[model samples]
Target: MKTFKSILAAILIVGTAGFLMSCESELESKGTASIGVTDAAVDAENISGVYLKVNEVQATAQGKTKTVVAFDSPKTFNVMDYQSGATYDLGEGQIDAGSYSELRFILDEGSYVKFKDGTTADLDVPSGTTSGYKVKGDYEINSDSRTNLVVDIDLRKAFVKTGSGEYKLRSTARIVNKDRSAVINGTVSGNTADKVVVYAYEKGTYKESETAEPADGESRFENSINSAVVANGQFTMAYMEEGEYDLIAVAYDENPEEDTYAFRSASEVDMMVAGSLLSVLKVEANANINVLINLDF
Candidate 1:
């Protein structure tokens, strides 16, 4: 009986060792996926903050969705704080090494916008709490390595003001592998308008409807891949994937009575037309290209 007990104990020890080995092997096959959030400048005036409450960040690979960052409680982020190539680190976690096709943020309730007049309005995120916000991109995760991703929430196209003066979040965001993206730096000269916005659209993707006035609770330039607010005659559209883009420069005039900026007519610029093509840019991974929009020409 003593001999039999000894054999049983040895078998148990072997099984435990095998289990640990399997766990270690599984861990070794995983890689870390880190995520962050950022925003392009909003075109509206008097908006001091655009806040979003995120409960989880997810990555989808091969039709499977896995959480990269799961907060114990909802985390509130002022997306405007991260602009012009800046990012707010969401979190990171181990995921199976492979190619991921999409990234998304599951938002919580209580999201709102703060105006400069000391007033705050709740932002209605349609299906944000349930379906979440999705950004499509191609990302690769190698075993034992870390992949960093940035979700560009182009607020200029996402924030919509309805006829009732209520605000809504209609995000048109994109995800980029931070390590494998490019930047477009540009300078716009002879733009005397109150404000200028540069939009980057995929080559051959610009449509006439994008330039027209949008319907109530909608936004123009909603199909743009990204945008940059021309500040001090300079703009930077960062985190773009390797591809060709058509840059469109638009001019705006401030209407203080309405507390907003109106799209300036192309006739106002005379020789320099607004909403004209600035350039057709082709970029590769990690490329930094500078372009000059000389409207004075």
Candidate 2:
């Protein structure tokens, strides 16, 4: 349980020889630390708002975890509104100058998601409402530098809907070093179909893989980045880490009777970024997107 100052003093004493050097370069000194949240572009077109009530924010270093900011009570954010670089500031505080290995957030009840059909349901965060959701990352906080972190709650992989209509929240948060992130913006056209979804999967992903859910404590990492839903034919992929990616847009049939879900995908598009440029791409859907599903029956 070393204070930020003591940790910095130790690093200075060692002249930041090894890991400390990398961390020091990546972290800030005498700067403020803030936590924000963003969405990973879900195809939940009917889901308008996914509000989460966060109770406490904590950071850990040197084997000791401390609450950086505890809500006087609790606060909620409609996660859907945070997309493509958009974020809801959880809060800010003086970050300790140490090698932080993890970050956690305690959530409370009163979390729910609303739908476009005027229906709303509770978002069940199994054990998360009281237990908290945590993820790992390296953070070095110096005295005068700003350290900002954003959490990517992959709504596509995190929010699961069961046959019995149970809404579950899986622990699938991706922490990002905000200063080193990029954004992707795009648009969809020739899509007259309802419930058209656009996703940014890692290149070489199988289209059917979208149905696979992550294990309780696993990352669904194989090209599973979801895309922000299109608004007025425009879409955005925010807070992306540097890498190559493939984009796919699908329009699904909502018929409940069929066990198999039928959908159409747009022609694949490729994306890549090495630095901080907000990349953009255009994806065209299959020409028959306007076809009626019931017509087949």
Candidate 3:
């Protein structure tokens, strides 16, 4: 009886050791994914900052979700500060080496927007804490290598004011492999409008309805792949995937009293003599393309 009990104990100890070894091996097989966030220019007047508190970032691979970045405490970021090709690193974590189909950002409360006049209003994120915001794309993580990713949040289309005189987040964001994306930089001259915004759409994706006034709680150019506000006669749309895109320049009337930029009209491009030969601009990975848009105001 004593000999049998001793053998049973030894077997239990061996089994436990093997289980721990398996877990360690699984952890060692993971790769590191470094994530960051960026934003395009917001198309509103007197807006000083857009703040967001991120609790964590998760990735889904083969229908299994795992955290790739977890903060000790919720990290608050002024997303507006990372515009025009700038990014804010959200830190890194280990993820299983595989192809992820989607990435989500879990946010916390206390997100708000500050205006230039020392006033702030709560920016509500619907289902931000529960469902989170998702960015769908194909991302590959190799074992023992670090992959860099940047989440581009186009604030122009994302920030909307509700009927109750409140603001809410209806964001459109995309995750791109930092090393595999490109940037579009250009100058907009000969403009007489109060403001100029450049919108980039996938080839042949722009529609006349996009220029129409959006319904309540919506904004124009909602379907643009990305957008940039002309600043000091220059504009930049970064982290764009390699493909052909159509550029649309639009004019706006800035009303500082109401803190709004009302849509005016879509500007005509100077087709004959501009930086880009064609309206359809071709962008390549890891390259910068300059497109000049001389608006016929």
Candidate 4:
């Protein structure tokens, strides 16, 4: 009886194991059938921070050229997945130069792009191009989801201005050469009065001679050229007649003959009665004004 019972028990165990295996297989097959693949579409609603380009540029009030990038701040961009027709909102993201970022779309199975609202109408993903995704729309508020995704964006550009305005020509001169190494400074008068008298020429002639003296007590020259002399060694001639004038400084050293030397600047400025402005032209704010001087030099 024991031997028969053992063999019967082994057979029953085998049969039960086989039945469980078949039931598991059937359950898996039913599950697969229940999960039927279906085609669906998604909705694209809110979008923001769309980047656009500008063509023309303008200068600032300060005469500076400026360039700028356009973008929306505190806005949310909506990302739509094309597959399963499901749409989700992707929060605001940075849009870098030379490239763009957008939501990925899903189509049949792993296929995507067709579902994206921005995808080309014909829904063709071009070769060599990442995908054919277009910016659909932009919005400030989220009406449907009630969930607000804020988008913050920054834009930047580089621009350069060519020239700068001319500054008032308030220059000073001092004797630094040998002999008359003394400092010669002087004050400018008239429209050039911006410069204050600092020093006079050490020892130099007006042009060629050691001292600029009146031709005679009778005053031969009708108009006396206006000149400024500083205590140190610098002097300036204003309202000078349009003519070639040489500048020289006189020095009183132990030896009187070679004590004085003539000096000139590396460059010379010629004044034309017609071309030169009688008065300084001042540019203030946005308007230009002509300034005249009446004080004696």
Candidate 5:
């Protein structure tokens, strides 16, 4: 009877060891990946929200692509509400450990924009729902580690007006590992911050036009290095890399077709870095950049 009991105990120990080994092996098979979606500053007057349905998020690895995680049911997001560095976390999932080169978003149809004037317009996609909007960036996934990837949607540039009261969708996305990106936020208070169009040009960007026939420095051809709409006097331009930029604020004189615009710069602020929130002065990683735009037009 004692011998039988010893044999049973050994069997149980062996079974437990096998189960533990199997669990560890399964855990090492994949890595944790979390993705977040955010929007850049979008200034559209009386525009309450721009909504789109995200079908799926795909990742490309070693010349092959797969859906890391997907919304079982399509998820709709208001791009305007997500502005000012606000982000929507898509949660985390496990993916094979490796280097990923590209991230693609399948933005399906059923997109629309709401105006505060009690009007709604359907956002048209030139290509329909056939293709996915892609942002190319590199990221690595290691075993038992978290890889955070962020995708910033620039609504100001993405939503383009066509002919009449219609608009076409052309997505312009910026993908970055959370560690390498930063946000720049501020308030443009003065005559009309909502009417102001702010531009953030690189350090070496020209104060003078590089092309001829330059119309008062703020040429349509010049194109500010980075531009965003000042919504209700509050604005934010996210995903600015680590570098210096010159801020140029412009308030246009009413006429929609008129080219007349007023330019204004802050009293004592110019340069900023990435990874932290900047209010008025510079912080370690990000910054909040407030510009009191006194438009004298």
Candidate 6:
């Protein structure tokens, strides 16, 4: 009897050891693996379409809030028809920041890219043009909250196709620090299209502008300025030394009668500078003078 009991106890102990070994082996097999982590890539989904309108423009030679019929809904005009319309969709993965990588807009009968953050683009359509634009700048998505986007546009690019029909517009825009903003506006007539080359400079005219230039020899010329097309009629200049300086808009038309690099107008109010800021100055004359360039906020 004693031998039988010892044998039973020995069997039970063996069985328990085998069970424990099996569990240990199973754990070792599974324990060699680890958890994984990843982030899904943004895809081309949720983007239905894109629509734009233009009711006003601000140019270096002209500044007005003229109402036009082109500020309507989508489908009336197709700027991307040449690219199979669907290619220009601006939702979900189609756009990064505010600009599109594979974006195709029927501009000047061709397409241009809006890369480089804070740089404005100018697009021109038949009989119209957009200016003071950037592909990446301050923007919001779905109005959820305000965030800086990779794309932006001013009046120059917004007014490119306002006239309807098959026409071409010329425009540009740019991005700079929030503390600096400047604009240049101009018009290209049907004849003088090829003979125009424009350039801009800053001139300070105050105590704080002691280092500013006043056109030729006004003061110090800071080379950090930037320019871009904002919309059909607006061009933004940025990154200027904070002080009162002339925002000189020069146009070079090859006509012998107008061959000099001339100002867009005479009443052009030279800037009275102080600190780094952003202001939307109105262009209203052959040259506007003493026009308050409000750079607040």
The residue-by-residue lDDT of candidate 6 on 206-291, one tens digit each, is: 13332332433111212213223112323333222233434433222234563323222211223332332323333322222222
RMSD, every candidate, angstroms: 5.2, 10.5, 4.6, 34.2, 7.3, 20.2
Best by TM-score: 3
Reference-based lDDT, residue 36, model 6: 11
Instruction: Give a tens-digit lDDT track for model 3, residues 1-297.
Output: 999999999999999999999999888788999998889868767789989999999999888889988887999989899988999989999989988988888899888999889899998887788767777788899888899999888787888877898888785677899998999888887888888888888988888788887888888887788888888898989999999888888888878788778888984353322334686787889988777777876
For residue 175, model 4's alpha carbon misses the true position, in angstroms, by 99
Runs of candidate 4 exceeding 4 Å displacement:
32-297
lDDT of 1: 0.82
What TM-score, computed on C-alpha atoms, does each candidate reach?
Answer: 0.83, 0.67, 0.85, 0.13, 0.66, 0.22
- Model 2 gets an lDDT of 0.65
Model 5: lDDT of residue 220 = 33
Candidate 4 vs. true structure, TM-score:
0.13
Could you tell me which 10 consecutive residues in candidate 5 have the lowest summed lDDT? Answer: 212-221
| Ten contiguous residues minimizing lDDT sum, candidate 1 | 265-274
Query: How much lDDT does each candidate structure score?
Result: 0.82, 0.65, 0.84, 0.22, 0.63, 0.27
Point out where model 3 deviates above 4 Å. Answer: 1-29, 256-259, 268-276
Evaluate candidate 3 by giving its C-alpha RMSD to the native, one decimal.
Answer: 4.6
Residue 38 CA displacement from its true place in model 5, Å: 2.0
- Ranking, lDDT, top scorer first: 3, 1, 2, 5, 6, 4
Which stretches of candidate 1 lie above 4 Å from their native place? 1-25, 265-279
User: Residue 109 CA error for candidate 3 (Å)?
Assistant: 2.3
